[model samples]
Target: MFSAAAALLAGAAAQPAGAEEETGSGHAVVRPVSGVSPLPADCGEPPIDGYVLNPNAEVLPTVATDPNRPWHLVTVYQQDRWNRYGSNGAVTAVSDDYGKTWRQSDNLPPFSRCNGGTAANGGDYEVTTDNWVTITPSGAAIAASLSLSRTGETTAILVSRSGDGGRTWDAPATLARDDNAQFFNDRPVVTADPYHPGVVYAVWDRVDATDAGWTQPVYLAKSTDDGRTWTTSKVYDFPDNSGVIGTQLVPLADGTLLIGMHHETDTTAATQVIRSTDGGATWSQPTLNVPAPFAVGVRIPDPDNSGDPIRNASLPLLAARPGTGVVSAVWQSQAADGTFHIDYAQSKDAGLTWSSPVRIDKTPVGSAAVPVVAASPNGTVAVTYYDFRNNTADPATLPTDVWAVTCKSNCTQPASWREQHIEGPFDARKVPLTSAGRLVGDYSGLVSVGRSAFTAVYGVATGDSANPVDIHSAIFTG
Candidate 1:
């Protein structure tokens, strides 16, 4: 179920409990997940759906810091089956050089199966989506969670932890132990407080029935000790369908927590959430922060086509920190010329508010979809957009590149976005300062060598398929 590198990483280190390989600012001592030197046959599965979400895939890479070894970068990924029949779990990789090489976690479930079920043709139903990863200061542990596929009608809140680097992990535990699950959950995100490395917070969509398979309302939960246990979750009841949704966590240098999400109905949606002085223990009412556009589309499976005219998708919270919680987010909208444009936004307040929505590109035009973001130590925010700016003319043409934009203090350069397709096969992006002012995007997300370079991991594309995405990384200087 793992690639050669992942199996090797697990075998390479028989670390003592609480041991960690050092680097900088709590990053994993990562080796590239798949190297250009020639992929090992056992590296891992190939890309799927012409997209990153494989039946058993790892996406949404995140870095966490360790207090004692503040140099190790431990990254975590949300793993499900390569097709759609696989269940939920996490796949982990670590970096020693700052976001480069990757090794899959051994002992740990390659996939976090909060709910067990047989995989039919690698397709499983009712599993987790959008997992958030974080690390503890002592370099003693790692934590994260997702919307677990519990029993009937229950999109349960699930959390998991790892001790001694990323080699092995503990079983996933639930966030809300009580019996008040009124709504279904989507996207579970976590952020460890800078001041209190032991403190962690998670925010997610708490809906009446996201069973419709879209987005809905939101709620939050907090943990005072790593991710061992969680407090009861509280739904942030909003005023109608136009409520708070798309929950993400951003912790400040002083332990303050900022939660960002989208606040709008079908016609008035915008990117926004809230901030908590006492962690997720309490939160203010929904705050109307950043402006982002959310569009709806449909996909009908076809046996004779290379593409769907309307492929619907949305981005969850990327990465966050203080003064720069939101770097980028994506949604679809129509340009003045009546073409669909993928719009993005960055937030500085950990989602308390956000910059205006910037249109990256429009349809010929088709549009961009599933955008994500990361914060750079140098104060730059890196954004990754899966672009299809030329798809209107050729349905067989897959997105040629995953592009990036580096911005500081809410960059709103609409005209600057005109220069598109600066990168490749990447689905994710992150800014690692030790590597320099580089902007990294991914077919996958990983970087290990350039302490001063931004790195990305992505999967290689061999042909056009519905699952055309996988994990790979590259480094760049912003």
Candidate 2:
């Protein structure tokens, strides 16, 4: 049943005009971009700025295999200087073989280097870059939303595409054309519904960052014509947007749109949901707010509400119904052991309601990174995250790896989580993915942690290893 469901979900998860074929090994094979075929880039030993070329770094592995080219697998990410930093600018790369060979799309769609130095209105924005990547259903189309900012400006959003698998692109068109001074950025999740893959949804937090204070609201837009044309702005009801953390979107089985939002608030805060039965035009008012542990009385807040060194620290995930409409949410609870305890909540009824939170990560690992929710048709649950509950790994720190645990069906989580070391040849571990072994880290860059069939994705730190990040991506399936 699970295998059968997976087949159907494969169809449902199709991006609108998605990626096409090519070949390589390990999940992907690297090669020269079509136009630059004979000219292999010198990624170098330490890699150069805007060209460090981790060729190993991978982000948001939107994986697909070309039907005609049974030997090739395709993956995509924002190329940049090695270190994972900077959302202000981004580039795209692809791998043909499973996860072995790779290539960066140098021939971009006539884009102006607006942010890096082209800050016409450019200014310093988040060091993070792109997180979400989507390809058309037929794998013929590709779209990526990048974070941007102008001189003395807040962060902005940009979208670019290519007809030939990340090859040459149309000069990236400014998706956030109305950037009057809003710092709307982070977590750009883009995907096309399977039924009508042509219809694309670009959802992100639209923030108003004026000196007075920052008011961030989650906004979503739909492109019926594959982004060539987009629907007018509509603010999806996610009051949690006050500082709405990552809002994960999943196209449900019954044509209903399900959204799982994680929150920063404590008592009154709980992951909430809103749905679009009629596409995205209308969304239900905020669902019953499911307060965090503090409010439930099961968990107590820090007496002082002390600030965690990591603000925007919490990461939540939604188990999207790849081909069906089953939605489940998972996250590390505030009452967590810091080492790596993860909890899960499900909304079988399509976001209308949720089950009580359950501790899904039972392994009691030393520490936990972020959690990812990848749903199979029969609801086979694949939850992956990092184990740092006890201590984190660093090239200078220690050996850290990406970990994952699986369940037989939806909601049937394991009693204890198991660890899988996913430190690519590079060994940078972060942003654990639910889809496979994917991780999101540094440049907002994403890649696979270690070398395993299960693909891991994360960013590489370049400058200062803390600032001006770029994005990278790759895939492996163990």
The reply for model 1, stretches above 4 Å from the true place, is 1-71, 78-89, 109-126, 140-152, 177-182, 209-217, 240-242, 264-268, 285-310, 316-355, 360-365, 389-394, 408-410, 414-452, 458-460, 464-469
lDDT per residue for candidate 2 within 164-235, as digits (tens), equals 545545544455644465555555666666567577777776655565555556677677776556654646
> For residues 1-478, could you state the per-residue lDDT of candidate 1 as single tens digits?
2443343334453322122223334232223452121212233334444323233334445555443332345665544332232225445566543444455555542223332322421112244445456666645445544443333244556666776656676666666422345555555666666567667677776656343433365666667776677775565665555565556776766455666665666577555556677655567764545454443322212112453332333434545433334434444455454344456665555555666676755323444544555555555555555554433333443434555554544455665542333344332112111111111211124221222234544433323233332455544433
Query: lDDT per prediction?
Result: 0.47, 0.45
lDDT of 1: 0.47
Leading candidate by lDDT: 1
Minimal lDDT window, size 10, model 2: 295-304
How far is each candidate from the true structure, as Cα RMSD in Å? 9.2, 9.4
- For residue 187, give model 2's deviation from the true position in Å: 3.0
